[model samples]
Target: MACPLKNPLFFLLFMFLPFPTTAQTYRNISLGSSFNALQDNNSSLLSPSGEFAFGFREIAKDGFLLAIWFDKIPNQTIVWSANGDNLVPKGSKVELTIDGEFMLNGKRIRNTEFVGIGVAYASMLDTGNFVLANRNSSIVWESFSYPTDTILPSQTLNQNGILYARYTATNYSTGRFLLSLQPDGNLVLATTRFPQITPNYVYWSVKNPNIGFRFIFNESGFMYVTSKNESLLSTISSNTVSMQDFYQRATLEYDGVFRHYVYPKSTSSSAQRWPKDWSTSSSPFVPPNICTSFMESTGGGACGLNSFCTIEDQGPTCQCPNGYSFIDPEDERRGCKQNFAPQSCGETSKEETDVFQFQELNNANCWGGDYALFEGVPED
Candidate 1:
């Protein structure tokens, strides 16, 4: 027998129960709450719109990247990451403890500048910013202040802000290129010495008379460098993509090209044909010709050593010459090695050198390559 206690007060009490919004799917994480790797249910915290997520993504079989990614997209495009250089193994945990201490595997996050008195809660906002707030509902720490390779709408980078590109598209470790908003008010794109933090050459830069103080990406999809008073000093990307209908992000891609991309929330728009996948917007490529502009004598050429670089519609492509092959086909950026054996210098006389022919590659020349010019040549 079921005993039903249906009273007038009980009927009224149901009116105020909280319900989820149509698009908003996430909830605030209270203090002392946590999630760990390998557990799908407790692992990720999604944004209010369910469009962005922050959690442990398994980058490898036993390796996980504590990162933020686009949740609704099929590609699961990663935007920002914490441990790109050092991937933590499975079972690692992140918690905002009961004592208001935020920690990852019981260790404080590096480079975090905490503000306010005490943290009470954490929330993943629809704008793609994860924030920690105190009892008074004031933000104490936020992910926007510490970005990785990508920046979403409404994010600002103060002077000295930097975006380091990943090694290869698949390999997420620090790579060959970086975009730096220098402390002295210069925004430059430069190549880095491999395996080192030293900047090698400036391939592109914004030269302005008035000093620039900050870099801003507004919600309307416009990017700009502003003065100390927040006046627009120069426009970096002026293209506009509405935030209401599209998910947007600008990234310093592994290929060393800084570009903006847009993902439609629904099917193709009436105004234009949008691809189901992410597509580049109205803004042009930062350094238009990578194969041509990336000729630095100090380091490997645009692609890598002993490799030829070609420009494709999507991006740059690297290929090995006739005699050379990629050292690591899995990673084309590792350069190339000769597949054929070299002739012994002692055995090969000046007359024997005639047997060896130089393969002429049409319209291709190696920049910064050592060469010896001959006065006269016989047509053989």
Candidate 2:
């Protein structure tokens, strides 16, 4: 059976593609192009094939973020974003000026080359890359070089390239976890203190003996690291899906898992080999088990403080311990707070003896380190 996504008109071709296409049919957004954050029907610059879009997205009412997303998808899933921590108001605008400067409301931005030829025009490529080119039509600046939490197919992360998870599923601010390809030629996943770039603890890592250069998610949907000679060093994920028939993205999720996901382009709900939604069919997810694997002694463990972690199908689930309630009900990863006042053992007054009772919790393990170790058993 043929896939519906194989039909170009069903997914790619539009009657009015808007911009003038180049020789390769890729649309080059000319200078003097501007998009107001007010978000109308024609606010974005679309890729030639209509597979991706580059524009401002409304994250909340009256709040917008400059973002790139899958254009044809029903939900328009965002792949990369700028200003997640600092969302702009309705009046903001993104434009390429007449003098060849990429400006976002009077501030120079997304200029990858500091000393090279100035920006002449921008193009949103079918590969989901938003690029700025010289007058000679050579690409000088691109979005692939500055990825957020996700990396699309054909994208490569060089040494020191890092992806920080969003604060939460919906909140795109920087989060507690990060995946980095270190300068020492090692790819590692670690927990980091919020608002701090320093790593708290490394939970997952793969070292290369011959020096790893780039971590690539190729067009075939395989993710791997290669040496300087382009020789295969290590396979991060060997799962191969048809990149032609589906949109692929490997994201370091908010839950601290680097997962590979594919969204089928068929538009038909009845799929034989893939699910109708974003499917994690053959993903070689990192850490394998985060609940038991993560051991960040400095801050909270994988599940935060005053909570115990259990693995769920989605990811690690954090549960507040008895006599403790979560500090924030909306976000469990923020940790829990004590429900009752604390009291030292045998410190109750004579009149309060009946009211004061020890809350005996079985298996009260001292995880995340707060107390000193003893050589012998304590006296009862």
Candidate 3:
């Protein structure tokens, strides 16, 4: 049984009581006070687009890395990495701390002290530069400075020193390989202690892209070329079309593979095709990936341990010359061996000595010998 009153004091008190206010959580890339306060938290990073947010995301089985690209751009083109290979997997208690450090399992990383535990943010600017800045607006790092594989229009491949890596077939570990661009504009790759090019320096390049440019490193570390219009957004031109305007860009793959990609500016109005008029052939076997594999296998048609196999019309070969026979034809890794037997002085009879004339073959797999003289042609 409850007592009822016409003027209810309980109702009045309830109405006047203050309600609890929940804290605001911001994730968009806006340029107002909301953006300022968000950075003040020291735990969020912005994506290149204001529409998409970036910080920490648990994707399938992969770990977390400082990634910035298009959140809604179908494919996540991770342009930069704070930690590319060093990924801490999901389900692990990890957070960007307020002191600009990343913390995992209570282990503090004070070096990243600006951002609080589990906190780091990125923002997109009109200039296309995604920057990692602090609350004071001081930039800690930016995507424009460090390039992974692509070189945008405004970016320059710095006039830096030697850049080379190993040739350990499948492994990324530096092997006996080198791909370096010399100050004289020559780009050469060789299998030696250091990168060295000879007098036949047929390969060299300059930085002269007439318009816009984009480069990428595939999952396999194969570098590719892509083009965009300087004035137009989302207009990707063909690698071949851009070369017509006397513009050239060279990319070296992680495997020390060199590719001369050309683009012509006049063909920008139409749909662009990759490599344009340029194509890859095995004849001269300019493709390092193809030639290198052949050389490694010593001409064996089959692939070798931790190595890719290929066939080529020129360059190194496993087959022996006509006058030579293989020491072990079954062993492709052993390469070829000459058949000439060294005899003791005056040990062989004069009749045992025989010489067969040889003819030169342009794409000959094995060396036979050189012809002495022409039958009917006059001497030079």
Alpha-carbon RMSD of each model:
15.5, 9.9, 23.1
Question: Clashes in each model (backbone N, CA, C under 3 Å)?
Answer: 0, 0, 41
TM-score of 2: 0.84
Model 2 lDDT tens row, 171-279? 8888888998888888999877556655667889999844988999999889998888899999988876776577889899887888888888864443456766777
Tens-place lDDT per residue, model 1, 1-380, is 00111111110000012222122345577776766777342367688778888888887667788888898888889888878888778888877777666677887665543542487777888888888888777888888888888889999888888888888887677888888888888888887766675566778888654488888989988989998987888898887777777788888888788888887876546324676677774555577656666655534566667777766567767788788888898777667788987765465466667667777666565666422122233343
Give the range of the ten consecutive residues with the poorest summed lDDT in model 2. Answer: 1-10
- The superposed Cα distance between candidate 1 and the true structure at residue 19, in angstroms, equals 19
Clashing residue pairs in candidate 1 (N, C-alpha, C atoms within 3 angstroms): none
The better candidate by lDDT, 1 or 3, is: 1
What lDDT score belongs to each candidate, Candidate 1 first? 0.72, 0.73, 0.33
Model 2 score (lDDT): 0.73
User: TM-score of each candidate?
Assistant: 0.85, 0.84, 0.37
Give lDDT: candidate 2, residue 379.
52
Residue clash pairs of candidate 2: none
Best by lDDT: 2
